[model samples]
Target: MSYDKEVGLRMNWPMIVYISLVHIVACYSIYNTITRPHYMLTYVWTIILWFISGFGITAGAHRLWSHRSYKARYPLRVLLMIFNSIANQGSVIHWVRDHRLHHLYSDTDKDPHDSQRGFFYSHVGWLLVRKPKRVLDAGRKISLNDLYKDNILLIQHRLCPWWNMLWCFIFPAIVGYYLWDESILNGILLPGVFRYCFVLHATWCVNSVVHQWGPKPYDNKSHTTENGIVAFIALGEGWHNYHHTFDWDYVTAEMGAIKQYNPTKVFIDIMYYLGLAYNLRRAYPKGWEHLKSRNIRKLGGEYHVVEGIYGIPPFCHRTVTYVQGEGGGGGRLLSETQVDNMSTTDEEGL
Candidate 1:
């Protein structure tokens, strides 16, 4: 069934035993490292997990499955699915259900991860506690037409939670035994414990900080807002405000086109461009231009005026006014070509 009432199972004992053993091994390894002090190796392992889990969450579960930003080839999808499972947030089906509900109800009492409940509540409390009745009601009503049909995603949904125990914890313990120079702590602590914990909070910040604090570019009433600080840590997801305003557009800064480091979009675009993926939906040039204007205004710039824009409807306004510097000054009205070129220049600078 696509939708059903969420049921509670007394926490799975087998899963608990498996996770605890992994933790014990990892802690032992960390203790070993305290005596050996292989800080460099620990750092290296941390970087590896950071990149893998970061991509797994962003390119795999998020843009790929949750947003359907682009399509991936089977091989890449399989690899990404494995890493996402290791990230151990939850099954894609569950994550998407909660995420789709967030978009539908947004900041209302129905939002599964609403920031109105406080930062910690939004970040992790919702996951730890029984879901609210309103959220369960919304989940039962949510449509899964897009997700239910994809065989690959369905496979991911089925295997991700199990992998959470094996790949996320057990594999790290095994890897520590083999390559961590007789130091299980280095392997388990750096890549296993730390990686899992870090990725969890990074993903959760989108529902928490991105909404509670940041600049609102498009629709101010939307509780979601853009947070650059959060994005840097969360792998370019900080542009939450832009994302909510135009969820259909693949990239955060309008159709996967960002002037700076949007590694998430970059990875997806590469896969799509290289024939490993396809059907990437981007905002029209005019839509992107409007976003730029709104961004400038939101970032304290003033007087964004664009004239004779072709694709934009005649009645559609194409300008923004905001404070720039100590004294506000006006810049030239930018055309689609101008905006593209300017963005290119900014990217080059980056």
Candidate 2:
């Protein structure tokens, strides 16, 4: 997170103050949770709330809305909206709009949270400062016409912070108070504020950590990676290489949820089983093997095959990195299919 490209941008005081106070409250809540064992239940509630809020992003905003990896019935859409509102990273329209921009421009100067600038900018500094004119211009070119069609999305966006507050903060606190006799103060600070803060950082890791670290299976070009530690914490979003290369894949990773901790996929699958989600999609890309082999030869290391957590065993694949450090790749996703459509010639087997 050392890098910074915020040189000419104006500071956003309101966002700065909100973020500053959020961290302060979140840290104080942690201290309270530690010193006051009586708040154990509240702490547990925080963990539970974190999962719920995370789903709103992983399932609702990023996958369902941003990429449309699957279609949801009205009931499911409404539920996802409520779930996302609880997360409050942004309303659906804004989240999808910015996320689409991120995928479109990726690490370029036009990318909203371009990783090329540095980890801090990609993770959270983008919010602290106004975006450069180049980024804002590209963002305008990327349309949100589809999102605007959803009246529910319009309502949420119209209400803005208040809608966010109702679900993310007030509702969680209300639940804690009624369910466990928790005081509104503790409920708000711990589960509402601290949990929100925790999820924010976890979500941000996909932008910063995976881009800088992890192995890139799909290619050896972009800074994206297949990060397991990130997937573990960020609910499978750490499959950055795959997600960036093949955004249509609802599972995000090529492997199923059992191979990784993708509760978000599990939730979507459950929704599908219940007939609330349909048109689930996946991509059938070619040249994965060719790309892997080519990169392996380029990097010039002896090859071995194995499957461990996010490929940490023999530390190699046909061309992808099973372990970490150098010799990996990622790309930008585009269109409703979320397909990069990268082409490669067929290669002889190694």
Per lDDT, the best of the predicted structures is 2
Per TM-score, the best of the predicted structures is 2
What is the TM-score of candidate 1? 0.73
lDDT of 2 by residue, 163-232 (tens): 9988998897888888888888788888898889989999999989999997665754678987778888
Candidate 1, 1-350: lDDT as tens digits: 12244466234456456545655655665676567666465667666777777888887777777788777788888778777778777776777788888888887778887777788778866665666666788899988887787676688677766756577756765665677553664566667776676777788888889889865545556777766667777778877766786776666553233433467777777777788888886765766566666555433354444333112221112223333344335534433333333443343212
Task: Provide TM-scores for the models.
Answer: 0.73, 0.82
Model 1 gets an lDDT of 0.66
What is the model-wide C-alpha lDDT for candidate 2? 0.77
Q: What C-alpha lDDT do the candidate models reach, one value each? A: 0.66, 0.77
Once fitted onto the true fold, the runs of candidate 1 whose alpha carbons sit more than 4 angstroms away are: 1-36, 176-182, 255-258, 289-319, 322-350
Task: Provide the lDDT at 36 for model 1.
Answer: 62
